[model samples]
Target chain A: MKYLLFLGCVIPYRISSYEISARKVLEKLSIELVEMPEFNCCGLPLDPVNHELMLTLATRNLCLAEQKGLDIMTLCPGCAGTLRKVNKALREDKKLKELVNGFMQEIDLEFRGGIVKVKHLVQVLAEDVGFKRMREAIQNPLTGLKVAEHNGCHVLRPAKYVGFDDPENPVILKKLIELTGALCLDYMYETECCGAPIIGVNDKIPLHLTGEKLRNVKAVGAQALITVCPFCHMMFDLNQPRIERVLSEKFGVPVLHYTQLLGLAMGFSPDELGLEQLRVKASKILNLN
Target chain B: MKNHDSTKPNSDGGQANDRKKEFGRTEHKIVLKASDLDPKFKYKISKIPGAERIMLCFQCGTCTADCPIAKFSETYRPRKLMRMTQLGMKDRVLSSDVIWLCAACFTCIDHCPQGVEIANVLRALRNLAAKEGLMPVVFKELVSNIRNTGYAYRIPELRLKRRAEKELPPLPKANLEDISKLFNLTHLSKTLEKEERQDA
Candidate 1:
């Protein structure tokens, strides 16, 4: 299956490993990913400040994917949520579609709305790749590793729009984790927000929230935390040291993008999946040490 | 105006002075004025996206109770904001720093029995706050970052060298012309321009 990969701003610049491992894993599964250089920010950052403008910007990206007659697949939950919401809004409301198209006229783009679907990578893996296929692709099963799943808010929130799984009780990510032969350890705050959305506004609150989740995961004895969104990965992975320092606790839980975990099980080395780039080392979990 | 005093005499016929002494406060009365309410504020908020249900809230504290941020910070309460918006206390709702504290997690919206989109209502309030130049400095910096570069955060040089070392493909540049045009067409540019002029 061919899809347009929308690498929203964060992955390309900050979290290249998510992109690298995702590309390699999808390639192994024979899913062709076409890169769209014209894609801009998914308009999430603008949502609170300017609702109409945010819709217009998200619609522009949707229109770009429509031109290719391919579905849009995103690595970030924020991008997936924004694009999915706008796509649903424009498709369901004619007046709103007209209003957004008016703004799109300036950019020489018009969204046909329903022509394309925006799928988060988690959705693509759970549904398109299928558990049977993923299991078959695993060359080295992770037998004893324990993982905590961090399903960030946007990917499964406002249940009506996202509709991927149960918002309160999501299991797609957990099931994907199990496919790699790792134990998806159940923990408190599994469905809580990573507080990434408000990180820019207030450092203290988001850090507290992230620290709380980290503490819970660490308490459960999970070797690592698995995530799908780049922003969540940032909070759990990049800021892990800072989070530990702030909370005065040592949580040696390595954070891995789902693709990275899947890549390891699929016979890809730690270096190949960019595990070395992570701040919290995955040596123990990956058996690298 | 009506004064509802909790320090008033109880059904046992105790004196107001006795109740005041019991409570140890002289200003325990809530003063409600008809003129203090902004009847148009609800309609104003309804105009914002995802906040059409602002008036549908029945003062149910589900949003507040389900809020993760509220669990930690006493000042951040979604249910109270909804009530303030409904009462047309525009200045109180928009000026308070609590409005900026919402994490936009949507847990409140997901669990709201009344189906009030609490998070989106907060977003609408934030937009109104920004228009009135009440946004925090960090949020303003993020807006400027997007306005100029089409991304929230700029990629640093060290990260650029690391990307090169990893042999990752070069990051794509944003179409700033279209981004700027959209910002200009919307009220964001005007609000930000006003903020800039005020700063200058």
Candidate 2:
């Protein structure tokens, strides 16, 4: 139950709350996370700019994890998706492996993909930490709280690459939400992109997409929106007010990382889970005094 | 959207005052001259991996129909782009601002009956655009950041301090020597240097 925690750039920079709560929840479940050492960006950010750069960088990270012989558990889906895609590609395609290794060899590394595995935190929770053990570990269940999920694009998408759940209708997050004893609500476009990736290019379209989701989430009377990616969390939580102002609609939806909800179910206090750091105040809906 | 002053990375255009200048540099006309069509353009794209199915796209419209960006954007149609690429409208497809709007959700990939993988083809097109040194400034900053710090963004100093305060292990320092080796071997730094000279 050990993994090298891959904290991509976003979690460390803008979304520390996710890291805080994820660490708390994983520790309670007895999943030991070793800090990944001397790794570069997972190569997603530069993918569109250059595919080779992405493949090479992602393979290099995989090699580092392979050297340690521990699977990678990432808080960010983008990191998990990129690493997994490259790992699979390099493993199956000899030519691609040689192309990536041509670059890896210069850096004194090799891409031996069969040795390591990359799993998103949700996958680790859903697959590795089975529900029966998790049910037994739950000291308190988040009964009566209403939350909906926004499983960001990368984790379940491009099904051929990182196939953990149904991409069209993701149920892993909903299942995990139910494990917390909170009522999981369904909202329109539940399995849609959060539009975080394109925010760097066209900010308005992303706001419109996120604003529409927020409007729909509010329409369904959800108390909070649960997300698994830091980028999705930013779009829904940190940018909630902005979305409201631009769309001329009010949606005070408190977005929580799925880990935070599970941490609460594990009886961890609000302060321990970094609930205070959320932009939209969640204490009232969460019934925290 | 012009009056909206924003310091965010993706606001109005990443690099200050460059959106108008960089994107859509080529003006596309509705009435196209035959010379605009590069007959071999589709072949050039299909040769690239992830875009091997570019010629197979039958314009099912499923990609644009399901694209979230296409819903809000007036111009970004993945189906139209596929047609344009196949029709050999290379310059028009390459220089269009709409191409960059895709969020790469892979919704197009999952739903396409032709196995066209529209998102991957879009990425391949974007890669070609990048080869011509036509890149957004945010990517330039990311390349520079990874080149300098081994991370995508230049993570702040205080955030590093806060990690220790919270009892988390200090953020791992990237091996710059190894990263630099990749950068040079891949010739990304050289490409970036050329881009910077053009930006200057």
Candidate 3:
């Protein structure tokens, strides 16, 4: 299957490994990941503040993807949720769609609500790649690593809206991890907040909440936490130290993108997955050399 | 607002007070102590040192409506959190796990009509929570892991060797000094000292 891969800001800039591993895994599964250039912010952060600007921004990205005649696959849950929401809402809201179209006219692009389908990489893998194929592709099973799944709020809550997984207890990520033969450790706070909302307003909340999520992962005796959202990855992987300094304590757990684990299981080396770019020391876990 | 005076006769009737006295006079006494406070005291955002524009909040639901996570989870209602912060009910706001759930989408800040910065308020509360030791235990462990490793994930040695094979940049090793510097930078250390003094 062919898909327009939107990396967004977090994955390419901070969570490069997520984008890399996702690409590697998709290629292995015989999925075509076409990179779309000149796509701006998903306008998600703008939506709550300015609906008009948000529509204009989101439609611009949709138009780019639509031009390629391919469905869009997003590794970041936030991107997937935001894109899917706007697309669906625009299709149903004619006035809003026209308003967005007007904005697009200035840029010489058109946004038709049904022009593209936006899906998370996990959804693509589960539905398109399939578990059986994933199992057959894995060279190293990640047998020893105990992983806890961190599905960001965007993927689940507002259950009727996102409609990807169970808001209370999402097992798709867990099932995908298990497919790699890694242990999916179930723990309290599995569905808890990672504090992504307070980032711009206050870095402290995300730090504190991310700290809490990491602690739960550690308490479960899991080796590390795996997530689908780059924002969640940033809060847990990039922002953990800020939280530690505030708390005056040490938590030994580490965070990873689900694709990073999948890439390793598929026998791809750390560098191939862009593991070096992480602020955290991810190399310490794998004996790739 | 009428100051809540428990010492005054119950507006409902003396029967309520008498019933409380029968159960235990202490209950009727409305025990007020420094320790009886909401353990997780949230600073009024307007009152937080250096955090401006908090007083502009008009209790509008624009922020709550605009939140990406709030649409998914009621636990992350930004408007409610803002209102709570303005009311000086720090304990209720600080103890809530909802504040920790925000994905920092910046959607709320963009949408808030009154210009009250909801996101910053959450940040301030989290910092205060850390100082008071009110932050969830899970959060404490995450901080510790990052302090020692520079990243939240615990990378196995095998992964490091593999990175070398792939020619990826080696992960940076964290040191005590770096972590200490970050700790001081957060200013949470000072908040801890201030909270301790308040307790004393």
Task: Calculate DockQ per candidate and list them.
Answer: 0.31, 0.56, 0.05
Residue B137 in candidate 1, Cα distance off native in Å: 1.9
Model 2 fnat value: 0.80
Interface RMSD of each: 5.4, 2.7, 13.9
State the displacement of the C-alpha of residue A273, model 3, in Å, after optimal TM-score superposition. 1.9
- Ranked by lDDT, top first: 2, 1, 3
Output the worst ten-in-a-row residue range by lDDT, candidate 3 chain A.
A45-54
lDDT by residue (A131-179, candidate 1, tens digit) is 8998899999888888899998888898966788998889888988998
Error of 3 at B156 (Å): 30
**Model 3 lDDT tens row, A1-289:** 8998876645544566776677777788889867675545565543332234445556667888888888888887777877887888789878777766765665667887687899888888887788888889989888777778988776665465567667667888899999887889998767766767446534554566677677778888877788888888887777777778877868756678888889889998887777776676765567532
- Model 3 per-residue lDDT tens digits across residues B1-200: 02112223332123334446666664336544455344333344455522356667787688776554554442456776766566565665555555555554444554566655576566666655555555433443344444455343445677667556655444434344533343444444454455457547
Q: Pick the candidate with the highest lDDT.
A: 2
Docking quality of model 2: it rates as: medium
Tens digits of per-residue lDDT, candidate 1, B50-156, equal: 89899899986988887777665646768878998999988767766667677777898889887788899998988887888766677677778777877777768
CA deviation > 4 Å runs, candidate 1: B1-33
What do the candidate models score in CA lDDT, each in turn? 0.81, 0.85, 0.65
Candidate 3 Cα misplacement greater than 4 A, ranges: A287-289, B1-200
- Docking quality of model 1: it rates as acceptable
Which lDDT value does model 3 have at A249? 65
Higher-scoring candidate on DockQ, 1 or 3: 1
Per-candidate TM equals 0.91, 0.94, 0.62
